[model samples]
Target: MLSKDALDTLFTNARTHNAWLDKPVTDAQLQEIYDLMKWGSTSANCSPARIVFVRSDAEKQKLLGCVSQGNFEKTKTAPVTAIIGMDMEFFEKLPQLFPHADARSWFAGNQANIDATAFRNSSLQGAYFMLAARAVGLDCGPMSGFDADKLNAVFFAGTTVKVNFICNLGYGDAQQLFPRSPRLSFDEACKIV
Candidate 1:
């Protein structure tokens, strides 16, 4: 178990920010987040998540068309929107990522295996990404309310990658936050056995 301060910093004190302060997230900060998130474990070490940082107005406009109305304003005003995606052909990179064995062959030509691996690992990476962002003093707004197909078509066309989620990163406006929501208790949401 972690210390109370560490746990609080990562979870209790971390808020899902919906409004930003017009502050830009430096490229170095983004790289730092990636460096931290990449250390997170994945099945067979198959890290499938790919991120495209949308910071320019042009890029933001491209994403605006894919996100729903609820997410449009917040995402548009954010300093950076990370397009978190999963690569269906991620196994091909196993030769380098999992070089100890023939891991590539393990997922070769299997659509179900590929999809499962991509979705699962990418989702795991997404969680890691959110934590890492919080750890590095950035507020995050993670949202799934978007048109995945349209996002993929606009950003990942001609590729085997698909959008899983999007996260807006920047300095948060605490004044705009709603009351904190409730959470499930350990016994109610977990299994001791």
Candidate 2:
């Protein structure tokens, strides 16, 4: 079990940050975060999620044009923004990622399975990415306010990868936080069989 402090750091005290500090996130830290997140499992180990870290002023400007008005300032100001996407052809790597069996053939030519698996697994990986970021003491503001097609055209052109969401990463500015929202109790949101 994690200590209370650790739990708070990863979950209890973690909040969706809309404001950012002027601090910079390092390349080493980004590498470390990906190293940790990549270990999480995916179905048939397809590992579909691909990430693009936008840290440069030019890239941020490009992204600024892609985000919705509500997300403009936070996204533009955050030290880093990650574009998380899924590779529709992820099954092509199954021989390397899940080599114990003929995993690739299961999804090969099966567009429906490929689509569903990529979406589901990449979404899971995105959650893992957030948790991994939290574990590394960074704050995140995940958003889906942008036009996915536009983002894809801009950042991932000529690739089968597609955007699922964007997350701003930085040392957050707590002074700008909104009031914490409530959550449902166990019985209210879940049920026992």
Candidate that scores best on TM-score: 2
Q: What TM-score should be assigned to candidate 1?
A: 0.96
- Can you give the lDDT of residue 147 in candidate 1? 95
lDDT values, one for every candidate: 0.94, 0.95
**Colliding residue pairs in candidate 1:** none
Candidate 1 positional error at 67, Å: 0.5
Question: Residue 180 of model 2: what lDDT?
Answer: 98
Question: Model 1, residue 15: what's the lDDT?
Answer: 92
The whole-model C-alpha lDDT of candidate 2 against the native structure comes to 0.95
Residue 190 error for model 2, in Å?
Answer: 1.1
Task: List the candidates' TM-scores in order.
Answer: 0.96, 0.98
Q: Per-residue lDDT for 1-193 in model 1, tens only?
A: 9898878868998899999997789999999999999999999899999999999999899999999999999998999999999999999899999999999998998889999989999999999999999889999999999999999999999998999899999999999998999999998899976
- Where is model 1 more than 4 Å wrong at Cα? 1-3
Worst 10 residues of 1 by lDDT: 4-13
Superposed on all Cα atoms, the candidates' RMSDs to the truth, in angstroms, are 1.1, 0.7
